[model samples]
Each structure stands twice: as structure tokens, then as C-alpha cells.
Target chain A: MRSHRFYTPWLLMLPALVWLALFSVWPAINTITLSFTNVHQLTGGHYIGFKNYWLLWHDPHIRDAVLNTIVFMVICVPLLTFLPLLLALLVQRNIRGIAFFRTAFYFPVIASAVTVALIWKWMLDDRGLFNNLLQTMGFVHKTVPFLTDRWLLLLSAIALTVWKGLGYYMLLYMSALGSVRRDLHEAAAVDGAGTVRRFWSITVPGVRGTMILISVLIAVNAMRVFSELYILGGATGGVGGQDVSIVMLVQQAASGSDGRLGYASAISVFLFFLTAIPLLFLTRLNKNNQEES
Target chain B: MTATTAEDSREGRKRRVRGTGAVRHPDRKGRSPIFDAPTPHGLFFRYLALIIVLLISIGPMLWELSTSLKSKAEDVYTQNIQLLPHHPTLGNYGEVQNTIPVWHFALNSLTVAVINVTGNVIGATLAGYVLARLKFKGRKLLLGVFVATLILPAEVTIISKFQMITSMGLGNSILGVCLPDMIAMTNVLLMRNAFMALPREVEEAAIIDGANVLQRMRYVGLPSVKGVLSVISIFAFIGAWDDFLWPLLVLQSPDKLTLTVGLSYLNGQWSHDPRTIAAGTMMALLPILALFLILQRYFFRGVAQGAIKG
Candidate 1:
């Protein structure tokens, strides 16, 4: 029986539905349509029949963006996936002052990307702390070009991203670790299995699903990275301006009065496919898990 | 073994709680003990590892705070890196204010964050309650719309959201920055999951008593979802307060910049001063960091209740 009046549910859902329809659903479809046109910030044109895609196909910056993204994903996915799990394992047990450790570890995750990246940028500057230390130790006679050089800058941002992400993924793994049955651990220990042995055999399998889910999250985030690269490499994306991510390129295209809205929309559509495929597959797996259960 | 005894006590407590309607108080079961087998041999190593990670995590923030405090008298770029400020002063913080309208930018950030938190609390709660409890046509489809949003990354939708907001002439305004994120889909789905986990029998009893939907929701629904509410509010605050890219995109007028955007502008455009920049970073960071420290237990408590199971 309907306990509420007919309009009640619709009344409740109005704000959320409005937001979704206006911002999310409309933008998603409109992005595709806008990609085909020759729309700029101040002027517009009719369908250009893949002209923007043609430009994207040849853009040198686009080439750098893709290459940088691949390098970022290759290194970050494995490091972020496993390191956080280990951090989670380290802080898993209820011990004296564990809460303090947990809170401290989570500080980077809570701090803004701009703030953390800026902190790193300061340290990485020529006269900054690391360079001064290196010079004092006689390891380098001169300062390191951490921020200006393209490769060093990229590596620095990657390190910053990995460092910032550890606590977040650790939290996710912590929750998953809570559900791993303790009896199994005790059983394994009694059977002469060591801590590492138990962790590999029991702990890994128990949180295996979570590990997969986190890797997907890491992969998608790696693909869409913007703020770290933006802050560390300045707005122009480091020395030769080739350290930019795809999102940075979209931001560049969509800004300014002469902004190429159509080109940016095309890039957005391309990015949606790159990042969304894994998540959609994960959703499918989630559905199947629910069904079988 | 001590591990077996601890497990037995935990098991016995669960059975007793189960007899009493299985109403698990969130505070009690939050500390799960998979690694609680305190082998005296492992304690030293565990503490050692914990301290090592703690230093790595918190050391940068501390260094930043110290840098912000140091006076110009001390050589800050020393090889040994003096962490303690000699003549520690709030002078650099005042300098950050002088450099850019940092306080005004912080106020702008506060406005955006407050709007977002208020919006999510009301909008996501109502929508989440209806989808979870009320029997309505198209409920599944409505939930699907929120779920569908998950597949598309927020960056993908940025150009269109920007187009819509600027077309509405809300560009260069904080409201425009707040509009797109106010009722985040994840928060809505989180709330729905929270409400669904509430036992329905009590709500049914309210229904039997001729309580209307809003009445039942106000009396029964709101109380049970406090954990989820707190979690979402904390996150919404952090998301808006610390956000950089969106505000940077929307606000062009220098006077209207948020803290993160403003600090970045200071970094990129200003005649550079490390002390002043460090001070700006700390001002934007410490308040939110303090807030997180206070409310974090609630966050873990909420997660442990299977709120993320959805």
C-alpha cells in the first residue's frame, strides 16, 4: 500500500533530479554534439564533420598528454595499489595510539592537492631544501632543475600523487580488512604459517575484490590527473610545455575568450571513453556478484 | 591462546547482542581485530613501522608550518633545515594577506563550502529517503540516473556544466562554483544506502499508526542516518573548501578567488617569497585539517557500519 501521496516522492526527488538532468545528463549528451561543431567562446559554427578530431589527431600536445598519462598510469597503478594495502596492514591492529597514527597518515589525503603540490614545489625548487641538502652533502656541486625540467617535473608530480593517495586507498583497504575473518588468521597461525604467509594466503584473498576495485579507481584517477601536474609544472606544463595531462589540455582549450569549446568537448568525449570503460565493467561485475549472492 | 579467548569474548558479545535485536552499537564493534594477535615479538616491529609511516606522512605538514613561522632573520634555505623558527611570528601570515586578499579569498571559500554542505544535507537526504523507503513509480530508474553518473568522470562533464553555468550568467560568482557540486550523486547514493540499512519494521509500525511519509521520515528516518549525514557533510565541506580547478575556471576577478586558487595565483604570479607562500598554504590547510581531526572517529564509525557496502 502507498503510505505517501502521489506527489510526495517526486517532491523529494526534485532537487537531485534537477541537478542530474541539468549538469550531468545534459552535459554528457551535449558534449558529444558540441564536439562536432566549431564553437568557440565568443563565436560558433555548424557541424564541422570531425574537423576537431582531425586537429586532435595531429596535435603534438595531445601526443605528449597521452604519453605522459601512460607513464603516470604504469608507475602509479602498481605503487598506489600495493603500498596502501601494506600501510593498512601495518595500522590494522588495535594498539596504543593507533588512532593518532591513522589520523596522521590521513593528513595528506585530506589536504588540498594545490597545497601539497605547492609544498613539494617549494622543496623541489633550485634553492629549495632537497637541492641545498644535496649540495651540502657534496653529492651535487650544483642545484637540481626539479621544477623546470620536463622529466624531473613529471616524476616529482607522480611521486606527490602517490604520496598523497596512500592514506586514502589505505582507508578503503582498512574497511575491507575489518571484514576478513579473524578465525581464519588464527587457524593459519596454528598451522605454523607465519605472518607474511597468512597475509599472502588468507588476507590477500579475503580482500581480493577490494584490491581489484581500488586498482580500477587508481587507474581512472591516474588517467584524469590534473591538479598535481598543473601546480608542479606551472600553467604552461613545465619547460617545453609537454608535461600536461589530458584534463589540463581540456582546461586550456575551454578557458579564454578565444576558447575552443568544441575541441575541448571533443577531448572530454574521448576521455570519457578512456576512463569509463573499466568502471562500467566493474559495475557489471558488481551486478553479477549481487545476482549470485 | 589469547587470540582464541579474545575471539570467544567477541563472539559471545555478538550472540548476546543478537538476542537483544542484534542492534550493534556503532562504537563497540568499530575496532575489528584481525591483527590484534599481539605477539610480543611483533609489537616492537609494528610500533617501529607505524612510527616510520607517521613521520613520512606528517613531516611535510610540520615543515610547512615551521616555514610559515620563520622570520626573515633566519636563513630558511639552510642545508640542515632549521625546523624551529628563531623569532617565530605571525608576520608572514599578515604578509600573505598583504600580498593577495587572502582573508577575502578564505571567506569566499567558506561561502562556497557552506552552500555546498547545506545543499547536500537537504537535497541528498530527501532524495535518498524517497528512493530508499517510499514506494514510487520510476524509483529504480531514478536511482539508475545517479548510478549512471558514476561511469562518467566529473572532468568529462566539466565543459558542459561550465557552458550551462556561464550561459546562466552565474560565471565569476561563487554560486556558479557551488551549483554543480551542491548535490553530489555519491552523497545521495550514500544516504540511500544508509536509510536502506535501517530496519523497516519500526517504520512499518509508524505506518500502522497512520503516520504520513514526511512524519515518519522526520521522526524515524533522520535519527538513524546521523553517521552518514556527518560523513557526507565533512566530505562536502572538504571538497568545496579545498577545491582548486573548478573555482579557478569560474572566477576570473582577482577579488573573487577561493583560498586554493588564490594561493596558486600567489605561487605563479607574485614576486615570489617562500615564507609568504608557505604561510598562505598553512592558512588554507590548518583549519580544515583541525576539523578533520575532530570528526574522523565518526568517519571510521560510519564506514565500519557497512555504509560503503552499497
Candidate 2:
């Protein structure tokens, strides 16, 4: 009976464990091993110790991708992280028709990234609605190249990301804001605290943990942003592949005409660390913040 | 001095009323204010902010809808931006159908998404039940392993997964596309959280009634977590439906393509025609949007639950 009891749980877990091992764990281990080799998709290659890493270190295109990704992350993190807080605050009211506003804000998050990117691409095209509006409003005489120009391409991608992601992050904050005791704000208000003062002192501190979570989520997403760039940048990354992200670089290296699987694995490994390190740092920072508070 | 004392007492009464959570009379109107209730000026600004946000959020999608409906002769290029089409027609949708095998892709997507949702809900629920209700050694470690995979991005493992699927002869098949994603860690965790939240005595009663583990799971465990199951189903469906990269990587044939990958291909093929692309995009978006509209409350609740527990 004891033995049966002991084994039953494992029996229940068997299918999931098998699935995880075959897919996640094995692939993770293979990814690490493949990163050390010079394997191509068609031709099997021998173990090349750190050669891919060395090439990655010296590769200009990889450098450009890394720089662009960082720039994109830097621009997006603050905008997405803080802007949603304001949105959440605005929508977190009990006023009439607030549900409509909340639903409207959350609308973009339901669409696929491909759909979102396609819509934005049409809007930002030289002859698209945005440029037409600009020209109509006399903002610019000539059509602006939103996706063709180098920096503007990056900016356009960032805008699409922020636009799509805003509602998701806002929803997170809204949930967090919901939990914050109403009386705390009321008490603070009665103590002669102004709107900004109460927001900083009470609301900010109240949702600090969620703020950390949102930032980490945004950071991870910012690093993994590929479909937007892929669709918007015409698959090769717009204008000299200047707007290519790290994941995009990995995809290009792995599946591009060259099909450098080993090199792509190395870039994937690089991306893994790049993502993991900041996540670790953020969690630790959050821990410290908690302790301090 | 009398007037000042009367005002102080009135303020105290207002605070007490708010503290007690009493509903004010309708005639009181805006006499007493809570922290969230903005003043008239603040209300003006709040509506202003909300309108701007609503526009920014849904404006592009509405624009896509408008563009999709516009007649080909309208010339979106040189024409001033029109919120509504001058001569609205479903002509672009027809063009999309003639241009690409859209229904074929939609059916493929539906197949993959349904299989994924069903597989995930069942698999995750059983695993979550075991983890939540059954006491076993190393269960904590097992749960830890499942949770750890959440952080490992799909990019890290795509190469090997692709290799494995191809070697297994599952490539270009819908099952191949759904295989890797059959058991999502998020769904498992969500289920675990859901099962954990249920009352323990209910399961104990089932066990005491001579019901077996499977019986208890079927009768007691599954019914209680229907909300979580629905959430899991919705998420799994959405994830599978919107999936581009894995489908893009796995399925190469046009006939086997999911809607997202097919639409992406269509976007490239029809780059010169914005209306056709918009129509295709809109078509791809409509089903998910309808699902979302019907299940908006559940969707928002699931997101909130994920944010909190996850």
C-alpha cells in the first residue's frame, strides 16, 4: 500500500515529465552542446571550441544587432513600464463607461503580433495613413520614411511594440492597483496629501512589486521581439539590417541562406544570458527594495 | 467660532461615512468625495486621457478595418486619411480569398489550436491535481522544474525542437506544430494554483467514500477548477492560433501553413496591395477578437490571476 501510494503520484506526473524531458530539457542540453560545435543544417560538422563565440565577438553585424536591441530595449522599457501606470490609474476609476475604456485599451493585446505589425506597417508606410495625415496637417511637406530610414525603422518597431504591449502592462498594473486598499488612499487624502503626493507615497509603493514584475516582463519581451521586426523590416531587417534584434539575428544566422546552426546556437546562448542576467539583477533589486521597505 | 465647529463636525461625519463604506444618498451628489472620485476638472482631464488612450489603442485596428473595406479606386496612397470608406465593399476580402488559400490556413490553425487547447487542459489538469492534492516526495522539486521552464524562452530551444520534430517525420504536419506546445508550463501552474485554492475537505470526502484517485479527480477535482480550465483553454487556443515562429519553422508547404504564417506570406506576396493585406489581417484577427469579446471577463480575470500568482 505504501509503495503504491508512493508510485501513484509519479504515475500521474509521468506524461508531463516525459513531455518536458523530451522537448524542453533535451532541447536545452542540445542547444548548449550545439553552441560548441560548427554544425550546419545539411552537413554535420566537428566540435569547434568557442569558434562561434569568437566570431560572434568580432562580428560587426552581431554587434549592430546587439546595439540595436539594447537601444530598442532602453527606449521601450521606460515608455512601456511608466506609461502603463498612467493608463492604469486613468482606467482604475468607478466612473461610467470605464469598462469601455478598459476594453479599448486592452484591444491591441488580443491581436497577434503579426496582425499588429501588419496594421502598423500599413499605417506607417510612406503612402500610408500616418504620412498622409502628416502631409494633410502640414507637419511635413514630403512623405517621411517611417520604416525605410534606419533610425525611423527602429523607432517604428518600438512604437508598434509599445502600442501593442501597453494594454497588457496596464492590465497588470490595474490588477495590482485593484488590490491596493482604498482606505489607504482615502486616509492619505484626508491627511492633506495632494494627488501627486498620494500617488508617489501610497500608490507607487503599493504596486512596487508589480512594477518590478512588469519591468522584467517588458525586458524579456523587448529582448525576444522578432516578429515585429521581421514583418516591418521586410525579414532582412530594414535598411542594412540596422533594426535587427538579437532573436532576429539568431533566426537569420540559423535559417538564412548560410544556415549556420552552430553560430545561431551561440547567439541564442548569448541571448539567454543577456535575458537571464538582467532578470536575475531585477529580482535581486526587487528583493533589496522589499527588504528596505 | 460656532460656524467653524459646525464645519469640523460635518467633515468628521463625512470621513466616518466613508470609513464605514456607506452608500451616500443620491441627493448628496458630489458633497463627499473618495480618493478615486475626481472633481469636475479632474473628470474632464480623465475623460480626455481615456479618449486619447482609446484612440491610440484601437485606432490602428479601426484603420485596418476601414482600409479593408475601401474600394480599390479610392487610392489610399494620395488620398487624405479617411476614417470611413467612401464606397465600402467586401471586395478586398474576395481578393484575399482569390489570392491565397485563406480558409485552408484557417482550418489548419483551428485544428492546431483545438488540439493544443484540449491536450493542455487535460495534461496540465492531471499534473496539477497530482502536485496539488497528492503528497509525494520530490513533488516540490518536480513543481520547481516545471516552473523553471517558464523562464527559458522558446528561442533557446527552437533549433533542437525543430531537429527532433523533423527527425520524427512529423514535419509539415499540424501535429508536429502542436507537439512541442502540448504541455505549457503556464497552464500547469495555473491549474495547480486553481486546484490548490479549492477546499481540501471535498477531496477528502471523495477519498473516504472509497473513490479511487481517478474517480476523485473526475468527480471532485475537475469540476471545481472549470474556471481555470477555461482560462487555460483560452490561453492555449490563443497561443496556438497566434503562433508564427514555430509554425513558420515547422510547416513549409503552403497547404500546411497556419493562418499567421500564411498571412505573413500573403503580406509579402501582396506587398503592393495594402487593402488585400489589411483584409487578410482582419480576417485572421476576427475569430480571436470574437472569442475575446465573448470571454472578455474570463480573459481579464485570467490575466489578473496570472499576474498575481505567476
Candidate 3:
């Protein structure tokens, strides 16, 4: 009976464990191993020690991609982190029709990134709605090349990302904000504090955990951003390939006609660390905060 | 003299109270303070802020809708920016169908999404039940493994996953697309949390009634976590449906392509025609939007709980 009891739990766990091993764990191990070889799609590769790493160190596009991804993350982190909080605050009131506003903000969260990207592409097109509005309003005499220009292309992609992400993060913040005690705000009011003071003193500190979580979430998301850039910039990244994220670089390298699988795997490994390090740092910080509290 | 002084004080107090009442109830309307009552200036600014935020959130999609409805006869390229279609037409939607196999791609997407949802719900439920209810050694370690997987980005493992799928001869098929995503660690964790929160007595009662492990799972465990199951299913459906990169990488045949990938191909094929792309995008959005609208309350609750717990 003891043996049967012990075995039943393992049996229940078997299917999930098998799935994860086959897909996640085994693939992760393979990725690390593949990073050392000069594998191509047609011809199998031999072990080439650190050659891909060496190439990665010297590659200018890799450098550009790393920089662009950092820039994207830096720009998006603040937008996603705070804008959603503000949106949540705005809708957190007991005002009439607040549900409508909340739902409107959350609409894009459920919408597919592909559909979102397509709509934004149309809007950002030279002859699209945005340029049309600008020209009609005498903002610019000539049509602006939003997607064709490198900086503007990056900006457009960032805008689309922030737009799509606002609802998701807003929902997160809203949930966090809901848990905040009403008496804190009322107490602050009784103490003759102004709205801004109450917000800064109470609301901000109240949802600090969520804020940190949001920041880390946004940062991780920024690092892994692919579909937006891919959809806007095409497979080669944007314009002169100036808009390539690190992940985009990996995709281009691995799937390109030359089939630099080893090089791609090296990039993937680099990406893994790049993403993992900050996450580890943040989680440690979260753990410390929890312990202190 | 003391009585006169007391009368004077009472009169002053009455005047003060009446004055305060006049100020508080300036509109002479008894509106419930708890419900629909805010100062006019405050309400103005609040509504203004809300409208602006609402416009910013949904404006682009609404613009897409407008563009999709715009007749081909109207020149969208010119300086004239119309918020509403001058001559609205359903022809663009129909044109999308004629241009590409939109329905076919959608069917592919639905198939992949449904299968993925099924896999995730079944797998996560079983695992979650074990982790939650069953006292097993190494449960903590297993949970840590799951959480670790959650933190790892899909990009890190895509290449190896692709290679593995190809080796198994699952390439260019929906199964290939669904295989890697069958067991989402996050969903399992969510389910585990949900199952753990259920009363212990329910499962104990089932066991006392001579129900075995699987029987307890089917009879007691499954029904209890139906809410979380729905949540997992919804998220799984959305994840598989919106997934672009995996489908793009795995599926080679045009016919095998999911809707998102097919839309990208459509974009490349009809690069200049915004109307067709807009129509297709809108068509793609409708089902998700409808699902969202219908299940929004549950979605909000699930998302909030998931975010907090995970």
C-alpha cells in the first residue's frame, strides 16, 4: 500500500515530466551543445570549439543588434512600467462607466500581435492614416517615411509594442491597485494631504511589489521582442537591417540560406544569459524584500 | 441671562449647520455620495482623461476598421483624412477571402489552438493535482524546475526544439507546432495554485468512498478546478492562436500555415493594398474580440490571480 501510494503520484506526474523533458529540458541542453559546432542544415557539423563565440565577439551586426535591443528595452521599460499604472489609477475610481474604460484599455491585450502589427503597419505607412492626418493638419508638407527610415521604424515598432502591452500591464496594475486598502487613502485625506501627495505617499508605496514585477516583466519582454520587429521590418530587420533585435539576429542567422546553426545557437545562448541575469537579479531583490518584510 | 445666552448659541449652531448643508448640497439634488457623485470639475477632468486614454488604446484598431470599410472608390492616399468611411462597403472582407485562403488559414489556426488547449488543460490538470493534493517527495524540486522553465524565454530553445521536432518527422505539421507548447509551466503552476486552494475535505471524502487516485481526479479534482481549467484553456487558446514565430519556423507548406503566418505571407503578396490587409486583420481579430467580450469578467479575474501568484 505504501509503495502504491508513492508510485501513484509519480504516475500522475509522468506525462507532464515527459513533455517538459522532450521539449524544454532536452532542447535547452541541445542548444548549448549545438552552440559549439559549425552545423548547417544540409551538412552536419563537427565540433568547432568557441569559433561561433569568437565570431559573435567580432560581428558588427551582432553589436548593432545588441545595442538596438538595449535601446528598445530602455525606451519601452519606462513606458510600459508607469503608463499602465497611471491608466490603472485613472480607472480605479468608483466613477460611472469605469468598466467600459477598463475593458477598452484591455482590448489590445487579447488581440493577436500579428493583427496589431498589421494595423500599425498600415497606420505607419507613408500613405497611411497617420501620415494622412499629419499632412492634412499641416504638420508636415511631405509624407514622412515612418517605416522606411531606421530610427522612425524602430520608434514605430516600439510604439506598437507599448500600445499592445498597455492593456496587459494595466490589468496587472489594476489588480494590484484593487488590493490596496481604501482606508489608507481616506486616512491620508484626513491628514490634509493633497491628491498628488496621497498618491505618492500611499498608492505608489502600496503597489511597490507589483511595480517591481512589472518592471522586470517589461524588461524581459523587451529583450525577447521579435514579432513586432519581424512584422514591421521583415525578416532582415528594418531598412539596412538597423532595427534587428538580438532574437531577430538569431532568427536571421539560423534560418538564412547559409544555415549558420552553430552561430545562431551561440547567439541564443548569449540571449539566454542576457535575459537570465537581470531576471535573477530582480528575483533576488524580490526575495530580499519579502524576507525583510 | 443664562437662558438667553443658551438660546443665542443654539441659533448660531443652527445657522452654521444650514450654511454647511447649502454648500454640500449645492445642486439641491440628493445624489448618492457613494455611487454617481463627484464634483463637476473633477468629473470633467476624469472623463476627459478617460476619453483620451480610451482613444489612444483602441484608436489604431478603430482606424483599421474604418480603413477596411472604406470603398476602393475613395482615395485613402490623399490628404483627406476621414475617421468614418465615406461609402462603407463589405466588399473588402469578401475581397480578402478571394485574394487568399483566409478561412483555410483560420481553420488551421483553430485546429492548432484547440489541440494545444486540450493538451495544456489535460497535462496541467494532472500535474497540478499531484503537486497540490498528493504528498510526494521531490515535489518542491519539481516545482522549482517548472518555475525555472517559466523564466526561460522560448527564443533560447527554439533552435533545438525545431531540430528535435524535425528529427521526429513532425515538421511542417500542426503537431510540430503544438508539441513544444503542450505543457506550459505557467499554466501548470496556475492550476496547482487553484487546486491547492480547494477544500481538502472534498478529495478526502472521495478517497473514503473507495475512489482510487484516477477516480478521485475525475470525480472530485476535475470539477473543483473547472474555473482554472477554463482560465488555462483561454490562455492556451490565445497563446497558440497568436503564436507567429513557431508556426512560421515549423510549418513549410502554405496550406499548413496558421492565420498569423498566412497573414504575413498575404502582406508580402499584397504589399501595397492596405484595404485588403486591414480587412484580413479585422477578420482575424473578430473571433478573439468576441471571445474576450463574452468571457471578459473571467479573463480579468484569471489574469489578476495568475499575475499575483505566478
Candidate 4:
């Protein structure tokens, strides 16, 4: 009877387990299998060995994607890590109209990625609002190329990405902050620590676990950026000039005008690893942080 | 215990400092410096930070509002873009609906969100209760598996999930949008945390009174975790409602498109005159804003309580 009871939890969890296996696990395996095959339209192509991987390595577009993705990830992860912690700190106090502030911060989160991209696209347009506003304010004499300019485009994307994402991470940090015992804060305060000192000594250490978690989450998300970049016409997997991100390159290889199955697979395979490395490091960091906390 | 006394004294001091209606409102002046005491520079810094955050965060939305009110002629050559409209008009909103079927897209989003929310609530609570209350084998393993899913980025599986849905004929339907998301892992973790935080004695008494697992769960566990369930459901609703990529890939027909996808189509066309697109986008976001307002009070309290409980 006791043994039978052991299976009850598994039985209860069966639906979710089944859903993940069928929808998530099987599809991943299939994607890997399909990555190696040639596209024959109907029957699909024969098993091509490392031909795809080889082609992916040599392709200039694929190479550009790899470089671009690295740059975006490197730049974004740190910004993503710090901004939310800062926002969480700023809003950690129980202020009036906190709900309004929260909703305001999270508004971008609720806004569709497409809407976000569109709004940014309009603002970034040469004759658009951003440049016009800046021009009027004497910030710039001419219309700044927010989208068309290669360097500026990446920054704008990062800005939008950070804006959309900051609130969710802030909320997570806020909740984690709430869990911290007040005694530590009291102790620090009594020791003549300033607000910043108290936060560093007591609050920061208290939410160390959450910080690591947020870091891992942000790193993984930053590495896998696609839709917003894609929508911004960064679809060409060339060395520069739109299609600038690595995910875009994988996408181009997957379903481009070229239709190179092997190349697409290789690019995806690289991306998988690129994303995985940071994620692995992140996990280790989180575990270490949790233990230390 | 010592903290409480310290907090009370601080509260008394805060009342003294404020001086207006001090006795009536025992303000946060007590306790620790973190919550109660205001530094001389704190309000200035707070407002400055708040203003900066609001600008960075709310700047784009304000830009959208400005563009939406701009005339097509003005939009093309408007040199000075004040956040306030020169001449605000509902013409864009009027034209947007006629140009594209906005209501159809909204309906699709609503249907998907509603179904997804219902599925999550049922599955999450039941599973959460069992994980939290029942002494079952492999519970820790199951929890580990659920937590592991959080690490598996949705982008990695998008291609595969699309293929699965298309093959299953669930593609292009509202079912496709909701089905995959219905078995959400984050909410399961949330619900489990909420359930676990409920005192053990209630369940022990239920068991002592000869109540079975199902009965006890129905009467005690469900009620206790309802707050968490609402929060998770709201989150799920928002996620499903605002989704873009999945709907873009699956829903091919213009009529079948969700609001976000439909707005994207509008955006590409009206790249010149984006006022209409902005109006449409704002319309799409209105329902969510309304929902948040209606449940504003509960959301913060419930989420904070649940997180602390975890």
C-alpha cells in the first residue's frame, strides 16, 4: 500500500511529463536528425555526413553571424545583469503608486515584441520621432541613423531588449529582497553603515542567490536573441548590413533562398553550443552563489 | 523580536519628523532605516531615478502615442516632435480597424489566453498540491525535472515545436498557441512554493480526520493556493496574449492572425504613416492594462506573499 502511494505523485505529474516529452524532447531529437539530412522537397535528402558542418564553417554569412552574436551577447549580458539589480534597488522601497510604477516598468514587457520593434523602428527612422526630438533639443544637427547605421543599430536593439526585459528581472529581485530578514539590516544600520553600505553588506548578500539566477537567465536570453533583430530587417546573414545576429544566420541557413540544410544545421549546432557554454558557466556560478549565501 | 521594538521606535520618530497628522499615521519611521527612515537626499534620488527609469522605460510608448496622433503629412516631415501631439486625431484608430480586421485578431488572442490560463490553473494546482502535501516517491526528481525546464530556452525548441504542431494539425488554430504553453513549468514551481508554504498542521488534521488526499486537496489545498493560481494565470494570460513569434510562424492567414502578428503586418505596410499602427498596437495592449488595473491591489500583495513564502 505504501509502495502504491509512491507512484501517486508520478501519476499526478504524468500529464506535464508527457507534454514535455512529446512537444519538447521528441522535437529536439527530430531537429538534430533533420539537420544532417539533405532537403529533397518530398522524400527529404540522403544522410549527408559532416558536409553541412563543413559548409557552415566556410560560409562568410555564417561567420558574420557567429561574430555578431558574440558581440551582442558580450555587450548585452553585463548590461542586462546590472540594470535590473539597479531598478530593483531603486523601487525596493514601499512607495505610493508602486503598482503604477511596476506597471510602467513592465509595460514594455507586456507590449508585443513586434509592437516594441515597430515603435523603435519608427523612432529610429531618419525622419522619425527620435532624431526629430533630438534635433529640436540641439542634441544632433542631422538625423541620426539609429537603424541604418550598423553600430547604432546594435545599440538600439540592446536598449530595446534591456527596456523590455528589465522589469521582469526587477520583480524577481524585489521578491527575493522581501524574503531577507530585517535583523541584518538593523544590525548593519546600528553599526553606522550608510544606506549604500547597508545595501551592500546586508541586502546584496541576502539576495545573492537571486542575483546569480537573474544573471544566468539574462545571459541565456541575451545569447538567443532573434525575433526583434529579425523584425528589424537584420535577416541577411552577411558580415554586416542587416541579418547581423548569429541566430539570424542560423535561420537563413535553415530556410534561406540557398536552402542549405547542412549549413543551417551546422550554424544551429554552433548556436546550441554557444548558448550552452554561458548557460553551463551560469549554472555553476548560481550553484556556487547559492552555497555561499 | 528586537527588530519589532526597533521598528516601533523608528515609526514614532518618523511621526515626529513628518509633524502633519503624526499621531494618526504611525508612519514607517520606526523599524529599520531601510523601510522607514528617509535620508535628506533619498527623495531627490528616488524621484531622479524614478524619472530616469520612467523616461527610458516609458519613452518609447510616449513616442508611439505621439506618432499615432501625427497626421500622415506631419509624420513624414514633422521636424519638431514634442511628446504632445500638435493635432491629435482618432483618424488612425478609425482607419486601422477598416484596413485590418482588429477584432478578429483580438478574439484569437483572448481565446488562446483564456484556454491557456484555465489549463495552467488546473494542472499547476493539482501537481503543486501533490508535490507540496503528499509524501510520494520521486517527488524531488519530478521537481528537479520541472526546474530543469526553466533552463531550456524556448528558442531552442521553437523550430521543433512548430514542426510538431504543424504535423499534429494544431498549427494555425488557437489550440496550437495555448497547448504548448498550458504545461508551463514556472507556474508549477510557483504553485508548489505556495502550496509548501501553507502550514503542515492543516493537512495533518485533515488526514487525522480521515479525509482522503483528493478531498483534503479540494477543501484545503486549493483554497490556500488560489492566490498563487490567480497570479500564475494572470502571467500566463499576459504571455499568451502578447506572444508574437509562435503565432507568426503558425497562423498563416491574415484573418487567423493574433493581434501582435496583425499589428506587425500593419507596421510593415504603414512604415511611412505609423500612427495607425501605433493606434492598433495601443488597442491591443488596452485589455491587459484594464485587467491589471482591475486586479492591481491583489497582484502585488499576492506575489510578494508567495515569493516570501517560497
Error of 1 at B41 (Å): 4.5
**Model 2 steric clash pairs:** none
C-alpha lDDT (0 to 100) for residue A181 of candidate 4: 70
Better of 1 and 4 by TM-score: 1
lDDT of 1 by residue, B1-310 (tens): 9997797668646655544532222236543233343656579889999988987888888888898999988888878767699899999998988889988999999999999999999999989999899987888887888888878888998988888888899988988999999998888899999899879899999999999888888899999998888888888999999898888888899999999999889996873888989999999999999999989999778767655522
Those runs of model 1 whose alpha carbons end farther than 4 Å from true positions after fitting are A280-293, B1-37, B308-310
Per residue, candidate 2 scores C-alpha lDDT tens digits across B1-310 of 9996697569667766664554242224332344344556778988988888888888899999999999988877874557888999999999999999999999999999999988897789888988888988888898899888887998888877877887799977899999999987777788888889879788777777788888888888887777677778887888888988888878878889999999888987745699999999999998998888888777666565552323
lDDT of 3 at B143: 88
Best by DockQ: 1
CAPRI classification of candidate 2? medium
Report per-candidate TM-score of chain A alone. 0.94, 0.94, 0.94, 0.86
lDDT of 2 at B188: 77
Chain B TM-scores, listed for every candidate in order, come to 0.87, 0.86, 0.83, 0.82
True contacts kept of each: 0.78, 0.69, 0.77, 0.49
Docking class of 4: acceptable
Residue B277 displacement (Å), model 4: 1.8
Supply the TM-score for candidate 3: 0.91
TM-score of each: 0.92, 0.92, 0.91, 0.86
User: Which model scores highest in lDDT?
Assistant: 1
A96-187: candidate 3 lDDT, tens digit per residue = 88877888888888888889999899988888888988888889999899988888888888989999999888878887887776667655
For each prediction, how big is the interface RMSD? 2.1, 2.9, 3.2, 3.2
